[model samples]
Target: MKVYDDKHIKNVVFVGAHNSGKTTLAETMLFEAGLINRRGTVENKNTVSDHHEIEHERGTSVFATPLHTEWRNYKINIIDTPGLDDYVGEIISSIRVADTIAVVVNAQNGVEVGTEIIWNYIDTYHKPTLFVVNQIDHMNASWEDSIKSIKSLVGNNMVLVQYPLKIDGAQCIIDVLKMKCYKFGKDGGKPEKLEIPEDQKELADHLHNELVEKAAENDEELMELYFDKGTLNENEMRQGIRAGMLNHDLFPVFCVSALMDMGSGRLMGFIDNVAPAAADLRPEQTVEGDILVRESNAPTALFVFKTLYQPSLGQITFFKVKSGEVNLNDKLVNSRNGETEVLNQLFIMDGKKREPVSKLEVGDIGATLKLKHTETNDTLHEEGKKITIKPIKYPQSRTRKAVNAVNQKDEEKLNDALRKIHSQDPTVEMEFSNELKQLIIGCQGELHLATIDWTLKNIYGVEAEFKEPKIAYRETIQRSSTANYRHKKQSGGAGQFGEVHMKIEPWYEGIPEPEGFNIRGKEEVDLPWGGKLVFYNCIVGGVIDARYLPSIKKGILEVMEEGPLTGSYIRDVRVMVYDGKMHSVDSNDISFKIAGAHAFKEAFLNAKPKLLEPIEELTVKVPEEMVGNVMTDLQSRRSVIQGIDSEDHFQILRCSVPQAELAGYSTNLRSLTQGKGTFVSAFSSFQAVPRNVQETLVSSN
Candidate 1:
C-alpha cells in the first residue's frame, strides 16, 4: 500500500435501511477497485463487511466495518455501516468521521421509514451526501417511484446524474450529465459508452440541462460561465457538482445493481473525482474550543473513535489521524488520563484483516492493537499536549430489561462482561437498582438486546436471560396528620425513655412553614432519590434536647428509604418535632431514633398516602395512516397524548405514560405498525397512580 496525501483521501460511509444493498455495494466497490478478486454476497455469509458471527446468525450487518480501495490516484476509505437502527451506535461513530455519506435505497420499496429515520441524523451533520437507487435490475424494481421518493427526501436539491433503463432485454443507464448511454452485458461487468439514442434524446437533453442548472446554483462563477456558454463542459460540471455537494445544496442520484456488478465502477469513479476530501471538509472543534487543522507537521494527534474486544484476539483500537503524522513506534499520551502509550504496530483495517503500514498520514483512518489504557472517544497526542476531540453523543436507551445469570456461579462474570460490552458500544448501559433489587440493562431495542445476549453466550460463555424490569415506585403523603410514640426499655443498668410527637405533611416547592407552631430551626434536606425532606425543630421549652434532633431525623430517613406503603423511596414530605418528653439519664440517640421511627410510621398511615410511578416522555414516529391504531394501543396503556405533529407523510406523536405500562413497548410498536414504526423515550417526572392502580399496587406490596 502507498501513503496518500490529505487531499487524495476521501472518507465515504455507506448507510441506509436493511436490505438496501449497502453491504453488497461496499463489497462490490472493493472488487471493482481490484482490492479483491471476487465479490461476496450477504446471503452467502462471506461478505467482508459482515464477517462477525453474530451478524452471520442474524443475517444483517451489526457493526461498522472499515475498508479501503486504492482507485486511480485516490485512496477511498469506505466504512460500511449497518442499515438497522438497532446498531445506531456503530453508525453514529462512523458518521462523525465521514467526509461524505452514501445513502442507499431499495428501488422495490422506495424510501423506507428506516431510511427517513437515519436521514434525520445525516441532515443534522450536513455532510455531503448522494443517493444510490440500488437493485434496479430486479424485475419488480420501479425507478420512477424511487425517483419520486428521492425528490421528496431532498426536495428541490435532487439532481439526477443517471437513471436505469432496459434496452433489447439488457440493462443500461442513461447518464444525463455527459449525455452518454452505458450498455451493460448479460454478466454486468463493464459498460459500453455510446451516444444517446434518438427516441430518448429529448428526455436525456431535458434532464441534462436540469443537472447543469442545479449544479450552477451553488457557485456564482459556474452560474456566470453557464450563462456565457450554452452549457458547462464535463470538468466544469464536475467542479460545480463538487461545490454543490460541499455546500449540501445538491444531492446527486445514481443507479446500480450491486449484486450483478453493474454501475459500481461508475459510482467509484465519481466518488474518486467529485467527493469532498477530508481536508476540504470543515476542521473539527476540540473539547477545549480549539480547531484541529489537518496538517501533517503540526502535531501527532489521533482520536480513538471505536474500540473492540475480540476473544480470539486482544483489544483492537481504531482511530483517525486528526492532525500531524504518526509512525510505527511513536509515543503518544492519552489526553484523558495522561498515560503514555507507544504505537507498536499500525495497520489499515479491511474487515478483520490488518494490513501493516509503517506510517499513517493526517486525515487517514487506521487501527492499532494492545493499548494499555486508551479507550473509545479518547484523544491521544504527543506528550504534554492538551487536545481532546469532541466525543460522539449517542441516543439514550430505548429498551430496558432485567438481566439475570442462568448459572448462579457466573453472576460476577456476567456483570464484568456487560461493563466491557458497554465500553465498546456506549448505547448499551447497565445499572443496578437497589429499590427493584434487579440488574437492568438498557439498549436500542429488542434486536439490540438480542445481540447483547448473543455476545454473552458466545463470547463470554455466560448464559443469561433478560426479563421485564420492575418499576421504581415512590410513596408520599397527601394530607397532614399528627401522632405520638413512646420508647421505654427497662434493661439492667439504666431505663431508656423517649417520647416523640411529629406532624407529617406533603412537601412542595416553596412550601410555607407550619401555621400552628413556632419555627425556630429548620433544616431542608434534598434527598438523593429525587425529592426533598424538610425537618423542623419546634421544641420551644427544650423538652427534647437539640443534640438528639439528628437521631430523630435519621430514624425518619430510615423509614423514608423504604416507604411504609411500599419498598420504594419516600419523597417530598415535611416532618415537625413540635413537642416530646425525654429522661436525662435514659434518653439517648438510640431511644429518640426508635421513638421517631414509630411516630413517623404511625403518622404516615394516618395521612392520605399515594403511590407514584415513573412517567416517560415518548415520541413515536410512524406513517399517518397508522396513527389511529397506534393511538388506540397507547390508550390501552393509559398513555396521555401530549401532541401530534406531521412531517412529510409521517406523524410524530408525543405522549406521557407510566413506566410499568411500557415493558415491551419497542417490540409492540414495531409489530403494530408492520415494522415501519420507531420511537424514542426518556424519563419524565413521577406522577401519582390512579385510585384503582394504587389499590392494586398497595395490596400486592
Candidate 2:
C-alpha cells in the first residue's frame, strides 16, 4: 500500500435510517473500486461492513466499520455507520471525523424518523452532506416523491445532480452535471456512458441549470461568471460545487440502486472528484479552545474516534491522523492520561480483516493493535506535546434496566464482562445505585440492552436477567416539630446514658431561625449524592458540650443517609440541637449518637413526612396527527405539560413526568407513533408524590 498525502485522502461517512441500504451502497463502492472481486449482499451477511455477530443475527449494522478503496488517484475512506437510533453513538462518532456525510435515503419510504434523527446530528456537526436516494430498482420506488419528501423534511437547499432513467424496465442514472447517461450491464458493473436521449434532455437541462445556479450561489465570483456567460465550464462547475458543499450552502442529491449496483460507479466518481478533502474541512478545536489544523508536516497527533474489543485482538483502537504522519514503532503519549504507547503495528481495516500499513498520513484513518491507556475520545500525540482533541459528546442513555446474574456467584464475572463492553463502547452506562441497591445498565434503547445480553451470553458465557430498576425516591419533611429521646442502659458498671432534644424543619434558601431558638453555630454541607444538609448547633451555655455536638450531628447524618420513613435518603432538612442531657461517665460519642438518631427519627415522623419522587423533563417530537394521542398517554403517566413547539409537521411536547412512569416508554412511544416519534429526557427535580401513590409506595416499602 502507498501512503497518500492529505490532498489525496477523502473521508466519507455513510449514515441514514435502518434498512436504507448504506451497507449495500458501501459494498458496491468497494466492488466498483476494484477493492473486491464480487459485491456482497446484506442477505448473505458477507458485506464489508456489518460484520459483527450481533449484526448478522439481527440483520442490521450495530457498529461503524471502516473500509477504504482507491479511485482516480484518491484514497477514499468509507465509514459505514449503523442506522438504528439505538446505535446512534456510532453515527455521531463517525460524523465527528468525517469531512462529508452521504445520508442515504430509502427511495420507497422517503425521509423516515431515523433519517430525521440522524440528520439532527449532522446538523449539529455542521458537516457537508449529500443525499443518496438509494434502492431505486424497487418496483414501487418513486424518486419524485422521495425528492419532495427530502425538500419538505430537510430543507430547500437540496439540488439534484442525477435522476433515474428507466430503460427497458431497468433503472439508469442520468448525470445532470456531465450531461450523460450511465447504463449498467446485467451484472451492474462498468457502466456505458451515452448521450442523453431527446425525451430526457429537456428535464436534464432544467436540472443542470438548477445545479449550476445552486453551486454558483456559494461564491460571488462564480455568480458573476454565471451571470456574464450564462453558464460555467466543467472545471469551474466542479470547483463551485465543492465550495458550495464545503460551505453547506448546497446539498446535492443522487439516485442509485445499491442492491443492483446501478449508478454507484458514477456516485464514486463524484465523491472522488467533487467531495471536500480533509484540508478543506474546518480546523478542529482543541479541549483548551485552540484550533488544530491537519498538516502533513506538523507535529504528529491522532484522535481516537472509536474503540473495539476483538476476540483475537484485545483492544483495537481506530484513530484519524489529525496533524502529521505517524509510522510504525513510533511512541505516542495518550493526551488524556499521559501514558506512552508505541505504535507497534498500524493496519488498515476492511470489515473484519486487517491489512498492515507502514505509516498513516494526516487525514487518513487507520487502526493500531494495543495501547495501554488510549481509548475512545483520547488524543494520541508525540511525547511531551500536551494536545487534546475535543471529545465526542454522546447522547444520554434513554432506557435502563437492573441486571442480575442468573448464578449469584457469577456476579463478578458478569460485571467484568460489562466493564470490557463499556470500554469498547462508552455509550452503555453501567452503574450500581446504592440508594436503589441495584446494578443498572443504561443504554440507548431496548435493542441496545438486548445486544448486551446476547454478548454476555454468547461471548462471555454469562446469563443475566434484566428487570425494571427501582426508582430512587427520597424522604423529607413538610413541617417543623420537636421530639426528645433518652438512651439509657444501666445494666452493670458504668451506665450508657444520653438525652437529645431537637427540632426538625424543612430547609430552604432563606430559612429563618426556629422560634424561641438561638443560633449557636451553623454549617451548610452538601451531600455526596445530592441535595444539602444544614446542621444548626443551637445549644446554649454548654448545655450540650461542644465536643458532643459533633457526635449529635454525626448521628443526625446517619438518619438522613437512611431516612426513617422508607429507608430512602433524606435531603434539605435543618436540624437544631436545642437542648440535651449527658452523663459524664456514660454519655460518650456512642451514647449521644444513639440518642440523636432516636430523637431525629421521632421528630421526622411527627413533622408530617412526605415522599418525593424523581421527575424528569421530557421533550417528545411526534407527527402532528399523533400529538393528541401522545398527550393523552402522558397525562395518564402523571405528567405536567410545560409548553409545546411546532417544527414543520412535527409537534414538540415538553412535560415533566416521574421517572417511574418512564419505564418502557421508549418502546411504547415507538409503537404508538408507528416508529415516527423520538424523545429525550433529563432529570429535572424531585417533587412530592401524590397522596395515594405515596401511600402505596410506603406500604410496599
Candidate 3:
C-alpha cells in the first residue's frame, strides 16, 4: 500500500437497490485491480463487503465496508453500502466522504423505488454521479429499457458512453465516446479492442456524434473545435465529461456484467481517467461554515463517520482525514468535547483485514482502535484548532417499539448493550418515556428492529422482547363546569376542616377571563406536557389565608398530572379558586390540598372530558397503479387524505393518521407496493380520538 496524495485519491460510494449487483460490482472491481486473488459472490456469502455473519444469513449487505484498489497510479477508496433502506444510515455516513457517487442499476429491474429513495439524498448533496447498469449478461436483460428508465429518472442529461450488444452469441460493448468495440472472451476478462464492425458503423457513428455534442456543450473552446472538426477525441471528451460531472450537469451511463467480469475493468479505467478525485471536489465546509483546506499543510483533522463494535474487538472507529496528515502516535483533540485522543495505530481497512500504515494523508479513509470519548460524527483536530467537520444527518426513525428484557436480571445488561449499539449506529436510538412508563427503541423499520433483537440474543446473550409502544395520549376538558369539595378530619388533639369552590373551563390562547368574578390575583403556568393552565383567585375578603393559595394550586396540578378520565396527563385547563373556607387552627395546607384536589377531579369529570391521541403527517410515494391500494389501506387505519401530488411516474400522498394505528405501517406498505413504496412521517398536532375508540381505551385502562 502507498500513501497517495489527495489528487490521486478518489473516494467513491456504491448505492442502489438490493440485487442491483452493487456488492458484486465491488467484488469485481477489487479483483480487476489485482488487489484480491479471486472475486467472491453474494450468493456464496464470501464477498468482502458483506462480511458480517448476519449479512451472510440474509444474503444482503448489512454494513458499509471500505476497501481500496489501485488503478494505474490512482488509489480508489470504495465504500460498498447496503441497498436495503433499513441500513440507510450506513449509506448516508458513507456518502459524507464520497467524492463521487456510483449508482448501480439492475438491468432487469431498471429504476426501482429504492433507487429513487437513494437518489433523493444524492441529489440533495449534489455529488458527482454516474450510473452503472449491471447484469447485462442475464437472459432477460434489456439495455434499451434500462436506458429509458435512467433517462426518466435523471432527465435528458444522461448520455450513454457505452451500450451492450451480443456479438455472435458473445457479449461485446460498443464504446461510443472512444468510437471502438470491445469484444470479450468466454472467460470475460481483458477485452480485445477492435474497430467498429461494418454493419454497426452507422449506429455507432450516430451515438458517437451525440456523445461529442454532449461533451462539447460544457466548454466553448470544445464546442468550437467540435463544429470545426465535426468530432472530439477521447481525451477531449474525458475532459468535458469530468467538468460536467464536477458541476453535476451531466451523468454518463455505462453497462457491466459484474458477476461475469465483463466491463468492470473499463469502469475502473474511466474512474481513474475522468472521475473527480478528492482534491478536485469543492472544499467541504466545517460546522462553523468555514471551508476546510484539503491539503497536507492545513491543520490535521479527522471526521469520525462510523463506529462499529465487534465481540472480538471492543470498538473500531472509521474516519477520513479532512485535512493535513495523521501519524501513528499523533494526539488530536475532539472538537466536540475538547478531549484529547491518541491515535495509537492506523490501518487501511479491506473488509475485516487491516493493513497497518504509518501515516494517512488528507482524504484517505482508515480505522483506529478505541478512543474513550470519541464517537461517530465527532471531529478530532490539532489541539489549538477549532475545526469541526460537518457531520452526516441521518433520517428520522420510521418504527418504534417498547423493548424489555424477558429475563428481569438482564434488564441492566440489556440497557448497556442497547446504549453501545446506539453509539455504533446512531439510527438505533432508545428513550425512556415517563408518561408511558416504558423504554422505547426507535429505528428505520421492522428489519432494523429484528437486527437489534438478534444482536441482543446472539452478541449480548440478553433475551429481549419488543411489544407495541404505548401512545402518550393527553386528556383535556371540553366544557366548563363547577364543583365544590369539603375536607374534614377528626382527631383527638384537633380537627381539620377546609372547603373549596372552583370553576373549571377549557383553556385556549387569547380567551377572555371570567366575566362575572372580581379577579384578585392570577397565576398562569405552561404545562410541560403540551398546553397551558390559567389559575385565578377571587378571594377579595381573604376567606382563606393567602398562604394556602399555593397549596390549592399545587393540589389542582396534582390532579392534572393524572387526569380523572383515563389517568393520562391533562393539559389546557383553567382553574379559578373563587371561594374557599378555612379554620385558622385546623385548616392547614394539607386540608386545603385535599379539598382542592377533590374539587378539581369532580369538576374535570363533569366538564365533558375528552381523550386526544398523537397524529402523524405521512408523505407516501408510490407508483400510480398502487395508489388505490395504498388509499384502501389508509382508509382502514382511519387515515385522512390531506392532499395528493404527482411526480415523475409516482403519486405522492400526504396523509394524516393517528400514531396508534401506524405500529407496523412500514412493513405493511412495503408488502402492499411490492417494495415499490416509501414514506416519511413526522409528529403533527394531537386530535381527539373517536368516541368508540376512546371508550375502548378508557375501559381497557
Worst 10 residues of 3 by lDDT: 537-546
Q: Tens-digit lDDT track for model 1 on 1-701? A: 79988899999999999999999999999999998998888889999889999889888999899999999899999999998888999998888888899999999999987888788888888899999999999999999999999888889898999998899998999999878899999899899998888889999999999999988788899999999997898888898999999998899999999999899999998999988898888777889998987799888899998888899777899999999998999999999899999999999999999999999898899999999999888999988667888888888888899999999899999999998898889889999987789999999998899899999999999999889987899999899999999999998988888999999999999887789888889999999899999999988899999999999999999999998887789999999899999998999999999999999999998999889999999899999999999999999999999999998788999999999999888889988998778888888999999999999888898
- Which runs of model 2 end up more than 4 angstroms from their true locations? 490-492, 518-523, 529-532, 536-544
lDDT against the true structure, per candidate, is 0.91, 0.90, 0.91
- Give the C-alpha miss distance for residue 475 in model 3, angstroms: 1.2
Q: Where is model 1 more than 4 Å wrong at Cα? A: 494-496, 518-520, 540-542
TM-scores for all predictions:
0.95, 0.96, 0.95
Clashes of 3: 0
* Candidate 3 segments exceeding 4 Å error: 490-497
How much is 319 displaced in model 3, in angstroms? 1.5
Error of model 2, residue 596, in angstroms: 1.5
Provide the clash count, candidate 2.
0
Better of 2 and 3 by lDDT: 3
Error of 3 at 135 (Å): 1.8
